[model samples]
Target: MFSSLFKRDDTFYTLLEASAAEARNCAILLKDVMTHMGADTSSQLDAIHQSRRKHKRLTQEVTERLCKTFITPLDREDIEHLSSALHKIPKTVEKIAERLALCPVQYANDIVSRQINLLDLGTVEVVNMVGALRKKAGMEHIQDMQDRLQHIEGDGDKMLMDLLRQLYNGKADPIEVLILKDLYELLERAIDRCRDAGNVVFQVVLKYS
Candidate 1:
């Protein structure tokens, strides 16, 4: 009976994966929003918000499970930290979506699209990293994945700087410049959130390995 009762709740990994998937969904939706900036993208924005909320619920479940369970697949703190990191990705993506909805159509240029693509790639990688936790992959493998996220985040930082440099060239409209700057920073942040989640997973592997 005790074996059945204490069957090692692995559902925490599942919930974390679901949260990571939601983060990826937000990135995908953000891409769609970028492509259709001139069109009414309220629906896409709504979808991103919904994904963030879903991730929030997953985070809550993780916390609740931590409260009820004595044993876990990972350190309790690692699980909580990872859950928080994953939740932030979608939350940040939702902010990006909101900003994109309000951004001027003319500013939805190729650079913005490239940045969003980078964001999407980062979130996808984050999902992979979280899922690998359940598989108990080797530290080297998880570190490789984490290193990719670091590179993606570095690229995002460079892209943001490039965008800012262009915006500050003194020829652009001041108001639009301000709006674009805010959006670009938010994109950078979302990518960083993915990197942060990767770092958490890599640390967890290091602990167990």
Candidate 2:
């Protein structure tokens, strides 16, 4: 009976780990979507959509399990918050992909790709921070991760401004300009989601630590 009780105690940690892994997978999918932005095939977009569906299902399953189980590895609220935040990562990625699919923008430059890469890096850091939650790392390391995410968000903001300026000032066609502008906005929102994820991790650390 004691061993069975111990296993139940570990279930919440396993759920958290799964959520973190899903976030990382979403990040990779978003990177691929950005990389293939100008490609002739829509395979990447399809793949991201599928991944988002899987993430949604996993999050729901974990949430249901959270409600059914009496014992959890951490606060019930923390598990719920973390699960919701992690699930949003892929949803944002899916939204970006959907926008890209509909937008007629043909990017002549690599600005979107560069911004997405930065966001992916920031996301990886956030995932690391979330994983550290299971181990209950020092407050200092969690703060550092939050700081890095903030810096990344700043970079994304700067890049978005520069891209907008170039789009309006350059001799590109009006329709092309509009398309690129919307695409940049979507990419910016994706980065914002990454920062939001980092914030969620920070809250978890602050609450439990």
Candidate 3:
């Protein structure tokens, strides 16, 4: 236990921060796609894919570093768990982009935009939480961020229900309904992925608190 003090490595924190930034970048790309519906989104989609690749590479780096290093600032399993959780955010965001690009609908409504906004907010909080790890931030602060994530997730669920209700009301064509529902659920899942990462952060803080 005494050696832990002098053996601390800050590289994990750097990798985690880079991963979180990628997640935020992915969210920003998704928001851009939503705001500029009907415009050429290939560039944005490519950007998301790039962010996803960067994040995946970061996650692998974290794992490889963990294997090589004898001591880590945090628990090995915790670092691995958090890295995996952070990777999911970009992966899900990429899926959302693919779904949107393939969607026949040329425009999005308030619901879609609102969902993307919530996702953006959630990713911002995630970036904050990951940064906090560098300082060994307090449990209360981490919990506060987790609460915000939970609220965003709740809002996402409600918004999805409202959207489905509109789709089920029977005015829209069946094909449109199918596409919209899939896209909506994908967006919600992306938000949920953020919530999952927050939960891992909360648990890590709780353990070391």
Better of 1 and 2 by lDDT: 1
Per-residue lDDT of candidate 3, residues 1-209 (tens digit):
54754576889999999999999999999887765567788888888888888898999999988877777889999999999999999999999888777765554777787898999999998999989988889988888898999999999999999999999998988988888999899999999999998888888888888
Please write out the lDDT profile of model 1 over residues 1-209, one tens digit for every residue: 55744668899989999999988998999898888798999888888777778778888989988888877888889998998888888888888888889888988888888889999899888989999999988888888888888999999999999889999999989997988898889889989999999999888888888
For model 1, what is the alpha-carbon lDDT of residue 125? 89
- lDDT tens per residue, model 2, 1-209: 55554455666666667766766676687766655655653887777777777777778888887767777777778778878877777777777677766655455356767877886887787678778887889899999988998999999999999888887886878988887888788778878877887887798788777
- Clashing residue pairs, backbone N/CA/C < 3 A, model 1: none
Would you list the clashing residue pairs of candidate 3?
none
The candidate 1 region of ten consecutive residues with least summed lDDT is 1-10
In angstroms, the error of model 2 at 49 is 1.9
Ranking of candidates on TM-score, top first:
1, 3, 2
Q: Poorest 10 consecutive residues of model 3 by lDDT?
A: 1-10
How far in Å is the alpha carbon of 28 misplaced in model 2?
2.0
Model 2 error, position 101 (Å): 3.8
